[model samples]
Target: MTTGNSGSPISRYTKDRKVGEGTYAVVYLGKQVNNDRKIAIKEIKTGLFKDGLDMSAIREVKYLQELHHINVIELIDVFTAHNTNNLNLVLEFLPGDLEVLIKNTSVVFKPSDIKSWLLMTLRGIHHCHRNFILHRDLKPNNLLLSPTGELKIADFGLARAMGNPNEDLTSNVVTRWYRAPELLFGAKHYVEAVDMWSIGIIFAELMLRTPYLPGKDDLDQVDVTFRALGTPTEQNWPNVSNLPLYNALKVYPPPSRQELRNRFSAATDTALNLLCSLTELNPGKRCTSTQALLHEYFTESPAPTLPSELPKNDVAGGDSDDDEPENKRRKV
Candidate 1:
């Protein structure tokens, strides 16, 4: 586990196996020779750009190195492989994630299970916001679950620092389905509330066990969001129409919050209220992470389950747990 002049990161690990692949990098499941601890090594593809390192790689390493929390993925080490220009990121390996749990029909999710997952997800986002960093991406797939049932937020490639009012940001940050209304309207100077909206959608998904809004394109995304939560107008979201792309959106009659209740009948009053606050059209009126943590939902009946008590299937992101079909992330 030593980083010598050769800068070979693979030298310290063994039993390398490819777990996933993306446009910019490939992930491998490996173990530390010294401690036999498992790890996820992200190998960044080189020679794709004129610059030395890819921007996403740089941003991921920079922000992840600074963020340290139980709900956040841990960046163990970073080094390049010998005889190669590629850089590798050593991260704490998570067995599975929330998406897998949701897709696993074998696992029945109680309200308490959803509460536990939401609490931990909020905790992670709270940590990021408290540090003034914005996790632009927040979806079920990005919420990694450890073997102990602890949830960890992963993927910092789209994350950036907040609180700079003068800096312009791109609205096309979050994934299409989970993107906030403000971003869809082309609001450049957005805040952390963007992530909050995604969390709200995730909460809804947790309750329903299906994607609340699966849009095919950008317009369809906005259309689907408006249909579910009601379209934002000048009265609801001040200055929203002034955004660059607001004029492109078609008109939609605002639906009442009762519609949301009907859709998520499984949610309690307190839980429903929290989701409403999170998916507020107006960022100014949206609930912050701190406020959401104190919501009455946490104190209600069927309290959040203990991490160790969560449903444990033999499947833990690998085939070793052959109790079920091998769940594989085909295109993450």
Candidate 2:
């Protein structure tokens, strides 16, 4: 809505056009005048200097500035509007996000498509883990697909860099559906494994074309996850029983393996097996992003599709007509 000076250093190369908006910031399509490069500019409301910019927005900028990987969205520049007291973040503009693509396409993805996405997503998250960064929020909406169909993990608002393995951070992180079991059970001393859980959920979503476990609330979410994967036993998730919130709820016996196989009938055995390992109810038992990337699932036959090789436009048809109501479609 508001345009700043064209000649200013911060706004020098970028021409802004509105693209997306959210509760805390507005995203714009920005083009670099000199290079003719297009990028996404996220403008955060910063009039209230007393409270400072939102921590989530600040966290995104800080970590993304340090991370460099092809699977991660690139942060091009940072700017601030002089008179309006707004902070602007310039990012490489992705053509569309996975949510939009999945909704638009009727074409069924071959196992290769799923493998490519999973590989890319895990690689991105693995990069974060290597740097001690954890992407607390990971979901379809947060994953952007370039016009060529290469998947890039975006939106690091809820991401954090862990300082010490033993230190406990805030428990209030991650989106509910993609949250790890340790987080759900109120474990603040989590590791990169948390992001792996989300990747598992994303992997399952890609394969099924639907959310794997959609819980109405935190309690219900944990219930659904455990029900689908079977409750964690002492053997499977050792420290789970010691979590702060672990005792508040009654435990159910673990579900039969056949039940899981039946529920995800369309998934290949390797895919289902990996999902189960990643989504283990105990964070300790869950597979790390790096380990999942090395699994047999990705090593079969031809390598996954590279970013430049994916279908560009109209790969399917148009956006799906069965999109959920605006209010019900939760953003990560």
Best by lDDT: 1
lDDT of 2 by residue, 176-224 (tens): 8888878888887888888898888888887778888899998898898
lDDT of each: 0.83, 0.75
What TM-score does structure 2 among the candidates reach? 0.88
The estimated TM-scores of all candidates read 0.92, 0.88
Model 1 residue 254 CA deviation (Å) reads: 3.4
Off by over 4 Å in 1: 1-10, 317-332
**How does model 1 fare in lDDT?**
0.83
